[model samples]
Target: MKTISQVSIFIENTKGRLANVCGLLGDNNINIKALTIAETPEFGILRVVLNDTEKAKKVLKENGFIAKIAPVVAVEVSDTPGGLAKALKVLADNDINLEYMYGFVEKASEKALMVLKFDNVEKAIDILQKNNVSIVDDKVALGL
Candidate 1:
């Protein structure tokens, strides 16, 4: 899989807070590829993989949202039995520790596109590549 930038925006857990973030992106024509929301009593984190990260972040900051970028891996896993287990085995063998991960499928051909966050990204990528795993490019991951 390829390494990509994941943008996490801090959003207040209120009625229209999420709506505001979505509206901002919608108005700017930015497409969100993969998203995961983690929440607490006070706030929520909107983790997104965007088609245009730079512009999205800039606009979010201008609107007073706290946005940060981090590296994450994207892998196109098979849509069959043991697909995910097989991939995870590769990382386990290589001693790669996964911090967190998320994914989605764009079509019937594939079941999942894995987005992973780990400390040793370079090593993890090298291992996956050598094992012939399909790694998606960060820019391409945005699916613009």
Candidate 2:
């Protein structure tokens, strides 16, 4: 479905909580591809794309962390001004609501990868595809 698996972890807003999660994943040989943190005064949601989603989730859970997998869309846009804007405009025009998004540039390519969460994932993908936007698959997004 051209969707990527993202692991969302519920974490306390305490010192070293972030580091502990990262350390657990790293110690287990799980490589993180991309990540973002949504936080409040009490806690934070750590969203991450990892090379091994299942393994990462298992490791985190075994360590007493709350983690779950969610589907997200990854789009590749030109590494130039307005590239992102043009893609976003397609969604806005089609009445798609963006939940949140994060991006990282490919060091070996002149393209940027955007990880997007939409209220309607399937609809968003269909709309974006019809509009000719490039959607990255799970394998590519995870660097597998």
Candidate 3:
């Protein structure tokens, strides 16, 4: 199954922390393709898809940030009403549980891209493919 490497950074909920992380990556020539932050009262998990996963992880770790990489599925959904629902319905019917999801529009394509985490990635990929859903590979996800 094809997957994208998502870099997640555990950051403090303090001023300049987000900027610091972004600045660090930018300074190192890492391009962020997609990003989302899930925050609590005390801290946040900064999840991002970057052009260079290993390099970004190394850069963040060397800067004293706690970063981890995980495989995630990126799928192309139609850019229309019910598009997301239709794709999700395929997963639902297959009894696949979704952990979380985020999305962004692809400037070069008419479809929107959804990044999803599933309880069973391999099974989810198989089901999605069997149902004719388009899965984006690492290269496409990173814009490479």
Q: Would you estimate the TM-scores of all the predictions?
A: 0.90, 0.95, 0.95
Tens-digit lDDT track for model 2 on 9-60?
Answer: 9999999999999999999999878889999999999999888988887888
Report lDDT (Cα) of residue 34, candidate 3: 79
Task: Determine the C-alpha RMSD for candidate 3 after optimal superposition of all C-alphas.
Answer: 1.2
Better of 1 and 3 by TM-score: 3
- lDDT ranking, best first: 3, 2, 1
Residue 78 of model 2 has an lDDT of 84
lDDT of 3 at 117: 90
Alpha carbon lDDT of each predicted model: 0.84, 0.88, 0.89
Residue runs of model 3 more than 4 Å from their true location after superposition: 105-108
lDDT of 2: 0.88
Instruction: Write one digit per residue (lDDT tens) for candidate 3, span 11-68.
Output: 9999999999999999999988878999998999999988899999888889899998
Worst 10 residues of 1 by lDDT: 103-112
RMSD of 2: 1.3
Model 2, runs deviating above 4 Å: 105-108
Which runs of model 1 end up more than 4 angstroms from their true locations?
A: 105-111
